[model samples]
Target: MTTEQLKLRSMIVTALFAAIICVLAQLIIPLPLVPITGQTLAIGLAATILGARYGTISVLLYLVIGASGVPVFAEFSGGISKLIGPTGGFLVGFIPGTFIMGYYMEKTSFTFKNAMIANTIGMFIILAFGTTWLKISADLSWTAAFAGGFTPFIIVGLIKAALASWIGVLVRSRLVTAKLLLPIKPIVKEESI
Candidate 1:
Protein backbone atom coordinates (compact mmCIF):
# COMPACT_ATOMS: atom_id res chain seq x y z
CA MET A 1 0.00 0.00 0.00
CA THR A 2 1.09 3.54 -0.64
CA THR A 3 1.91 5.85 2.24
CA GLU A 4 -1.37 7.71 1.83
CA GLN A 5 -3.33 4.47 1.82
CA LEU A 6 -1.55 3.27 4.95
CA LYS A 7 -2.23 6.53 6.74
CA LEU A 8 -5.88 6.44 5.78
CA ARG A 9 -6.22 2.88 6.91
CA SER A 10 -4.58 3.65 10.21
CA MET A 11 -6.87 6.60 10.79
CA ILE A 12 -9.94 4.53 10.05
CA VAL A 13 -8.83 1.76 12.33
CA THR A 14 -8.07 4.21 15.11
CA ALA A 15 -11.53 5.73 14.88
CA LEU A 16 -13.07 2.27 14.83
CA PHE A 17 -11.27 1.32 18.01
CA ALA A 18 -12.44 4.54 19.64
CA ALA A 19 -15.99 3.58 18.80
CA ILE A 20 -15.33 0.13 20.17
CA ILE A 21 -14.24 1.67 23.45
CA CYS A 22 -17.39 3.75 23.56
CA VAL A 23 -19.63 0.76 22.93
CA LEU A 24 -17.81 -1.35 25.47
CA ALA A 25 -17.94 1.41 28.04
CA GLN A 26 -21.70 0.94 28.21
CA LEU A 27 -21.31 -2.60 29.53
CA ILE A 28 -21.58 -1.84 33.22
CA ILE A 29 -22.05 -3.66 36.48
CA PRO A 30 -22.94 -0.90 38.89
CA LEU A 31 -21.29 -0.63 42.26
CA PRO A 32 -21.42 1.76 45.16
CA LEU A 33 -18.33 3.75 44.24
CA VAL A 34 -17.81 2.99 40.58
CA PRO A 35 -19.25 0.61 38.09
CA ILE A 36 -17.37 -2.31 36.60
CA THR A 37 -17.29 -1.52 32.92
CA GLY A 38 -15.77 -3.08 29.81
CA GLN A 39 -13.72 0.05 29.14
CA THR A 40 -10.55 -1.56 30.43
CA LEU A 41 -11.06 -4.58 28.25
CA ALA A 42 -11.54 -2.37 25.22
CA ILE A 43 -8.46 -0.39 26.13
CA GLY A 44 -6.44 -3.57 26.37
CA LEU A 45 -7.67 -4.76 23.03
CA ALA A 46 -6.85 -1.42 21.41
CA ALA A 47 -3.29 -1.48 22.70
CA THR A 48 -2.74 -5.08 21.72
CA ILE A 49 -4.03 -4.53 18.22
CA LEU A 50 -3.15 -0.94 17.33
CA GLY A 51 0.23 -0.71 19.05
CA ALA A 52 1.47 2.34 20.93
CA ARG A 53 0.73 5.28 18.67
CA TYR A 54 -2.60 4.36 17.18
CA GLY A 55 -3.87 2.74 20.35
CA THR A 56 -3.14 5.86 22.38
CA ILE A 57 -4.79 7.96 19.72
CA SER A 58 -7.88 5.80 19.88
CA VAL A 59 -8.06 6.19 23.65
CA LEU A 60 -7.56 9.92 23.45
CA LEU A 61 -10.28 10.20 20.86
CA TYR A 62 -12.63 8.30 23.10
CA LEU A 63 -11.86 10.58 26.02
CA VAL A 64 -12.31 13.74 23.96
CA ILE A 65 -15.61 12.49 22.66
CA GLY A 66 -16.86 11.57 26.10
CA ALA A 67 -15.61 14.79 27.58
CA SER A 68 -17.44 16.73 24.92
CA GLY A 69 -20.78 15.56 26.27
CA VAL A 70 -21.15 12.51 24.12
CA PRO A 71 -22.85 9.78 26.13
CA VAL A 72 -20.05 7.33 25.56
CA PHE A 73 -18.97 6.67 29.08
CA ALA A 74 -20.24 4.04 31.48
CA GLU A 75 -24.01 3.68 31.66
CA PHE A 76 -24.27 6.12 28.75
CA SER A 77 -22.94 8.90 30.90
CA GLY A 78 -20.54 11.46 29.45
CA GLY A 79 -19.37 15.09 29.48
CA ILE A 80 -16.44 16.69 31.23
CA SER A 81 -18.13 15.88 34.51
CA LYS A 82 -17.63 12.21 33.91
CA LEU A 83 -13.96 12.94 33.56
CA ILE A 84 -13.75 15.27 36.55
CA GLY A 85 -15.97 13.11 38.68
CA PRO A 86 -14.59 10.70 41.22
CA THR A 87 -14.16 8.05 38.54
CA GLY A 88 -12.55 10.44 36.11
CA GLY A 89 -9.09 9.37 37.09
CA PHE A 90 -9.67 5.96 35.63
CA LEU A 91 -10.77 7.49 32.36
CA VAL A 92 -7.80 9.79 32.28
CA GLY A 93 -5.49 6.97 33.22
CA PHE A 94 -6.57 5.12 30.12
CA ILE A 95 -4.25 7.26 27.99
CA PRO A 96 -0.99 6.34 29.64
CA GLY A 97 -2.19 2.84 30.41
CA THR A 98 -2.97 2.19 26.78
CA PHE A 99 0.32 3.69 25.64
CA ILE A 100 2.41 1.69 28.06
CA MET A 101 0.58 -1.50 27.29
CA GLY A 102 1.16 -1.09 23.59
CA TYR A 103 4.72 0.09 24.10
CA TYR A 104 5.50 -2.98 26.20
CA MET A 105 4.24 -5.27 23.49
CA GLU A 106 6.14 -3.34 20.85
CA LYS A 107 9.36 -3.55 22.83
CA THR A 108 8.95 -7.17 23.74
CA SER A 109 6.79 -9.29 21.45
CA PHE A 110 3.15 -9.26 20.58
CA THR A 111 2.56 -12.67 22.12
CA PHE A 112 0.00 -13.79 24.63
CA LYS A 113 2.56 -13.80 27.44
CA ASN A 114 3.65 -10.27 26.71
CA ALA A 115 0.09 -9.11 26.33
CA MET A 116 -0.78 -10.58 29.74
CA ILE A 117 2.13 -8.83 31.41
CA ALA A 118 1.45 -5.56 29.64
CA ASN A 119 -2.26 -5.67 30.30
CA THR A 120 -1.65 -6.55 33.94
CA ILE A 121 0.65 -3.57 34.30
CA GLY A 122 -1.86 -1.39 32.52
CA MET A 123 -4.61 -2.55 34.87
CA PHE A 124 -2.58 -1.57 37.91
CA ILE A 125 -1.77 1.81 36.39
CA ILE A 126 -5.46 2.53 35.95
CA LEU A 127 -6.30 1.35 39.44
CA ALA A 128 -3.52 3.37 41.00
CA PHE A 129 -4.57 6.55 39.23
CA GLY A 130 -8.21 5.93 39.96
CA THR A 131 -7.64 5.15 43.62
CA THR A 132 -5.57 8.23 44.22
CA TRP A 133 -8.06 10.41 42.42
CA LEU A 134 -10.92 8.75 44.20
CA LYS A 135 -9.38 9.51 47.56
CA ILE A 136 -8.94 13.17 46.68
CA SER A 137 -12.09 13.66 44.69
CA ALA A 138 -14.33 12.05 47.26
CA ASP A 139 -12.45 13.41 50.29
CA LEU A 140 -12.12 9.87 51.55
CA SER A 141 -9.31 8.23 53.45
CA TRP A 142 -6.74 6.20 51.56
CA THR A 143 -8.02 3.05 53.21
CA ALA A 144 -11.53 3.81 52.09
CA ALA A 145 -10.36 4.51 48.60
CA PHE A 146 -8.47 1.28 48.48
CA ALA A 147 -11.44 -0.63 49.73
CA GLY A 148 -13.80 0.86 47.21
CA GLY A 149 -11.62 1.51 44.17
CA PHE A 150 -8.67 -0.83 44.41
CA THR A 151 -9.57 -3.87 46.48
CA PRO A 152 -12.88 -4.68 44.86
CA PHE A 153 -11.51 -4.82 41.32
CA ILE A 154 -8.52 -7.08 41.85
CA ILE A 155 -10.01 -10.43 40.92
CA VAL A 156 -12.29 -9.02 38.26
CA GLY A 157 -9.42 -7.05 36.78
CA LEU A 158 -7.27 -10.15 36.57
CA ILE A 159 -10.00 -11.99 34.75
CA LYS A 160 -10.36 -9.14 32.28
CA ALA A 161 -6.60 -9.01 31.85
CA ALA A 162 -6.49 -12.68 30.97
CA LEU A 163 -9.38 -12.35 28.60
CA ALA A 164 -7.84 -9.33 26.90
CA SER A 165 -4.50 -11.07 26.55
CA TRP A 166 -5.93 -14.25 25.06
CA ILE A 167 -8.36 -12.55 22.75
CA GLY A 168 -6.03 -9.70 21.86
CA VAL A 169 -3.17 -11.92 20.78
CA LEU A 170 -5.48 -14.00 18.65
CA VAL A 171 -7.08 -11.00 17.01
CA ARG A 172 -3.79 -9.20 16.52
CA SER A 173 -2.25 -12.17 14.80
CA ARG A 174 -5.19 -12.46 12.48
CA LEU A 175 -5.18 -8.77 11.66
CA VAL A 176 -1.49 -8.87 10.90
CA THR A 177 -1.92 -11.86 8.66
CA ALA A 178 -4.79 -10.24 6.84
CA LYS A 179 -2.86 -7.00 6.33
CA LEU A 180 -5.34 -5.04 8.40
CA LEU A 181 -2.53 -4.32 10.84
CA LEU A 182 1.19 -4.33 10.45
CA PRO A 183 3.20 -7.24 11.82
CA ILE A 184 5.53 -6.72 14.72
CA LYS A 185 9.19 -6.59 13.77
CA PRO A 186 11.49 -8.78 15.84
CA ILE A 187 14.46 -7.13 17.52
CA VAL A 188 17.81 -8.21 16.21
CA LYS A 189 20.86 -7.92 18.39
CA GLU A 190 23.98 -6.62 16.68
CA GLU A 191 27.34 -8.07 17.66
CA SER A 192 30.67 -6.34 17.15
CA ILE A 193 32.49 -8.03 14.35
Candidate 2:
Protein backbone atom coordinates (compact mmCIF):
# COMPACT_ATOMS: atom_id res chain seq x y z
CA MET A 1 0.00 0.00 0.00
CA THR A 2 1.03 3.57 -0.53
CA THR A 3 1.89 5.80 2.42
CA GLU A 4 -1.42 7.63 2.19
CA GLN A 5 -3.34 4.39 2.05
CA LEU A 6 -1.54 3.11 5.11
CA LYS A 7 -2.24 6.29 7.01
CA LEU A 8 -5.89 6.17 6.11
CA ARG A 9 -6.17 2.58 7.17
CA SER A 10 -4.53 3.36 10.47
CA MET A 11 -6.91 6.21 11.10
CA ILE A 12 -9.94 4.07 10.38
CA VAL A 13 -8.74 1.25 12.57
CA THR A 14 -7.87 3.61 15.40
CA ALA A 15 -11.32 5.13 15.33
CA LEU A 16 -12.90 1.69 15.19
CA PHE A 17 -11.01 0.60 18.29
CA ALA A 18 -12.10 3.72 20.08
CA ALA A 19 -15.69 2.81 19.32
CA ILE A 20 -15.02 -0.71 20.55
CA ILE A 21 -13.78 0.70 23.84
CA CYS A 22 -16.91 2.77 24.16
CA VAL A 23 -19.16 -0.19 23.51
CA LEU A 24 -17.27 -2.42 25.92
CA ALA A 25 -17.22 0.17 28.66
CA GLN A 26 -20.98 -0.10 28.84
CA LEU A 27 -20.74 -3.74 29.88
CA ILE A 28 -20.42 -3.20 33.59
CA ILE A 29 -21.02 -5.08 36.80
CA PRO A 30 -21.65 -2.36 39.30
CA LEU A 31 -19.73 -2.24 42.55
CA PRO A 32 -19.88 -0.07 45.60
CA LEU A 33 -16.81 1.89 44.61
CA VAL A 34 -15.62 1.10 41.09
CA PRO A 35 -17.56 -1.20 38.85
CA ILE A 36 -16.10 -4.02 36.82
CA THR A 37 -16.16 -3.12 33.15
CA GLY A 38 -14.90 -4.40 29.83
CA GLN A 39 -12.86 -1.27 29.30
CA THR A 40 -9.58 -2.95 30.26
CA LEU A 41 -10.30 -5.89 28.00
CA ALA A 42 -10.88 -3.54 25.09
CA ILE A 43 -7.70 -1.67 25.95
CA GLY A 44 -5.73 -4.91 25.84
CA LEU A 45 -7.24 -5.89 22.54
CA ALA A 46 -6.46 -2.48 21.04
CA ALA A 47 -2.84 -2.64 22.15
CA THR A 48 -2.34 -6.21 21.02
CA ILE A 49 -3.81 -5.50 17.62
CA LEU A 50 -2.91 -1.88 16.88
CA GLY A 51 0.53 -1.69 18.54
CA ALA A 52 1.77 1.28 20.54
CA ARG A 53 1.05 4.34 18.46
CA TYR A 54 -2.33 3.52 17.04
CA GLY A 55 -3.50 1.83 20.23
CA THR A 56 -2.67 4.88 22.31
CA ILE A 57 -4.39 7.07 19.78
CA SER A 58 -7.49 4.95 20.01
CA VAL A 59 -7.47 5.19 23.82
CA LEU A 60 -7.03 8.96 23.70
CA LEU A 61 -9.87 9.26 21.25
CA TYR A 62 -12.08 7.21 23.51
CA LEU A 63 -11.28 9.48 26.45
CA VAL A 64 -11.93 12.59 24.49
CA ILE A 65 -15.29 11.37 23.29
CA GLY A 66 -16.32 10.34 26.76
CA ALA A 67 -15.10 13.51 28.33
CA SER A 68 -17.10 15.50 25.83
CA GLY A 69 -20.36 14.19 27.23
CA VAL A 70 -20.73 11.39 24.74
CA PRO A 71 -22.03 8.96 27.33
CA VAL A 72 -19.41 6.42 26.36
CA PHE A 73 -18.18 5.59 29.80
CA ALA A 74 -19.30 2.90 32.18
CA GLU A 75 -23.04 2.70 32.88
CA PHE A 76 -23.49 5.02 29.91
CA SER A 77 -22.09 7.89 31.91
CA GLY A 78 -19.75 10.49 30.47
CA GLY A 79 -18.47 14.08 30.57
CA ILE A 80 -15.63 15.81 32.45
CA SER A 81 -17.25 14.80 35.69
CA LYS A 82 -16.81 11.18 34.78
CA LEU A 83 -13.19 11.79 33.98
CA ILE A 84 -12.59 13.51 37.32
CA GLY A 85 -14.87 11.25 39.27
CA PRO A 86 -13.60 8.61 41.68
CA THR A 87 -13.14 6.13 38.85
CA GLY A 88 -11.60 8.75 36.61
CA GLY A 89 -8.10 7.64 37.47
CA PHE A 90 -8.82 4.31 35.87
CA LEU A 91 -10.16 6.14 32.85
CA VAL A 92 -7.06 8.30 32.62
CA GLY A 93 -4.78 5.38 33.27
CA PHE A 94 -5.97 3.70 30.07
CA ILE A 95 -3.71 5.89 28.01
CA PRO A 96 -0.38 4.82 29.50
CA GLY A 97 -1.58 1.31 30.11
CA THR A 98 -2.50 0.82 26.48
CA PHE A 99 0.72 2.40 25.28
CA ILE A 100 2.95 0.24 27.47
CA MET A 101 1.07 -2.91 26.61
CA GLY A 102 1.32 -2.23 22.90
CA TYR A 103 4.92 -1.12 23.22
CA TYR A 104 5.86 -4.39 24.90
CA MET A 105 4.24 -6.37 22.11
CA GLU A 106 5.96 -4.22 19.53
CA LYS A 107 9.37 -4.65 21.19
CA THR A 108 9.12 -8.38 21.75
CA SER A 109 6.48 -10.22 19.74
CA PHE A 110 2.71 -10.40 19.42
CA THR A 111 2.52 -13.89 20.74
CA PHE A 112 0.03 -15.02 23.39
CA LYS A 113 2.69 -15.19 26.08
CA ASN A 114 3.81 -11.64 25.44
CA ALA A 115 0.24 -10.41 25.30
CA MET A 116 -0.44 -12.04 28.68
CA ILE A 117 2.56 -10.37 30.25
CA ALA A 118 1.68 -7.04 28.70
CA ASN A 119 -1.96 -7.23 29.67
CA THR A 120 -1.10 -8.26 33.22
CA ILE A 121 1.24 -5.31 33.61
CA GLY A 122 -1.33 -3.02 32.04
CA MET A 123 -3.99 -4.28 34.45
CA PHE A 124 -1.83 -3.45 37.45
CA ILE A 125 -1.07 -0.02 36.09
CA ILE A 126 -4.77 0.79 35.80
CA LEU A 127 -5.50 -0.61 39.26
CA ALA A 128 -2.67 1.28 40.86
CA PHE A 129 -3.78 4.56 39.33
CA GLY A 130 -7.40 3.91 40.12
CA THR A 131 -6.71 2.83 43.72
CA THR A 132 -4.61 5.86 44.49
CA TRP A 133 -7.13 8.18 42.93
CA LEU A 134 -9.94 6.45 44.74
CA LYS A 135 -8.26 6.94 48.08
CA ILE A 136 -7.65 10.59 47.45
CA SER A 137 -10.94 11.43 45.77
CA ALA A 138 -13.11 9.61 48.23
CA ASP A 139 -11.10 10.70 51.23
CA LEU A 140 -10.90 7.11 52.32
CA SER A 141 -8.07 5.29 54.05
CA TRP A 142 -5.56 3.36 51.97
CA THR A 143 -6.85 0.16 53.47
CA ALA A 144 -10.38 0.99 52.40
CA ALA A 145 -9.23 1.87 48.91
CA PHE A 146 -7.34 -1.40 48.67
CA ALA A 147 -10.35 -3.35 49.81
CA GLY A 148 -12.69 -1.66 47.37
CA GLY A 149 -10.56 -0.91 44.36
CA PHE A 150 -7.57 -3.23 44.43
CA THR A 151 -8.29 -6.51 46.15
CA PRO A 152 -11.70 -7.09 44.67
CA PHE A 153 -10.46 -6.96 41.12
CA ILE A 154 -7.31 -9.04 41.26
CA ILE A 155 -8.79 -12.41 40.35
CA VAL A 156 -11.24 -10.99 37.84
CA GLY A 157 -8.57 -8.82 36.30
CA LEU A 158 -6.33 -11.85 35.79
CA ILE A 159 -9.14 -13.66 34.08
CA LYS A 160 -9.78 -10.69 31.79
CA ALA A 161 -6.07 -10.42 31.07
CA ALA A 162 -5.88 -14.04 30.07
CA LEU A 163 -8.94 -13.65 27.91
CA ALA A 164 -7.58 -10.57 26.21
CA SER A 165 -4.25 -12.32 25.60
CA TRP A 166 -5.80 -15.41 24.07
CA ILE A 167 -8.34 -13.54 21.99
CA GLY A 168 -5.99 -10.77 21.04
CA VAL A 169 -3.38 -13.18 19.71
CA LEU A 170 -5.94 -14.97 17.63
CA VAL A 171 -7.52 -11.83 16.22
CA ARG A 172 -4.20 -10.14 15.57
CA SER A 173 -2.99 -13.12 13.60
CA ARG A 174 -6.10 -13.12 11.48
CA LEU A 175 -5.97 -9.39 10.81
CA VAL A 176 -2.35 -9.67 9.75
CA THR A 177 -3.14 -12.55 7.45
CA ALA A 178 -6.04 -10.66 5.92
CA LYS A 179 -3.96 -7.50 5.56
CA LEU A 180 -6.39 -5.50 7.61
CA LEU A 181 -3.51 -4.83 9.96
CA LEU A 182 0.14 -4.80 9.03
CA PRO A 183 2.68 -6.83 10.93
CA ILE A 184 5.29 -4.82 12.75
CA LYS A 185 8.74 -4.79 11.18
CA PRO A 186 11.84 -4.95 13.34
CA ILE A 187 14.30 -2.10 13.15
CA VAL A 188 17.79 -2.85 11.93
CA LYS A 189 20.87 -0.63 12.07
CA GLU A 190 22.53 0.13 8.73
CA GLU A 191 26.25 -0.42 8.41
CA SER A 192 28.57 1.86 6.46
CA ILE A 193 29.28 0.49 3.05
**Best-matching candidate per TM-score:** 1
RMSD (Cα, Å) for all candidates, in order, is 1.2, 2.2
Angstrom error of the Cα, residue 124, model 2: value is: 0.3
lDDT of 1 at 47: 93
Query: What tens-digit string does per-residue lDDT give for candidate 1 at 1-193?
Result: 7667666777788999999999999899999998899999999999988888999999999999999999999999889998889999999999999999999999899899999999999999999999999999999999999999999998999899999999999988887776677676757688999
Where does model 2 exceed 4 Å of error? 186-193
| Model 2 C-alpha lDDT per residue in residues 57-138, reported as the tens digit of each score | 9999999999999999999988999878899989988999999999999988889999999999999999999999999999
- Global CA lDDT computed for model 1: 0.92
Candidate 2 to truth, TM: 0.94
Whole-model Cα lDDT of every candidate shown, in order: 0.92, 0.91
Instruction: Estimate the lDDT of model 2.
Output: 0.91
In order of appearance, the predictions have TM-scores of 0.96, 0.94
How many times do residue backbones clash in model 1? 0
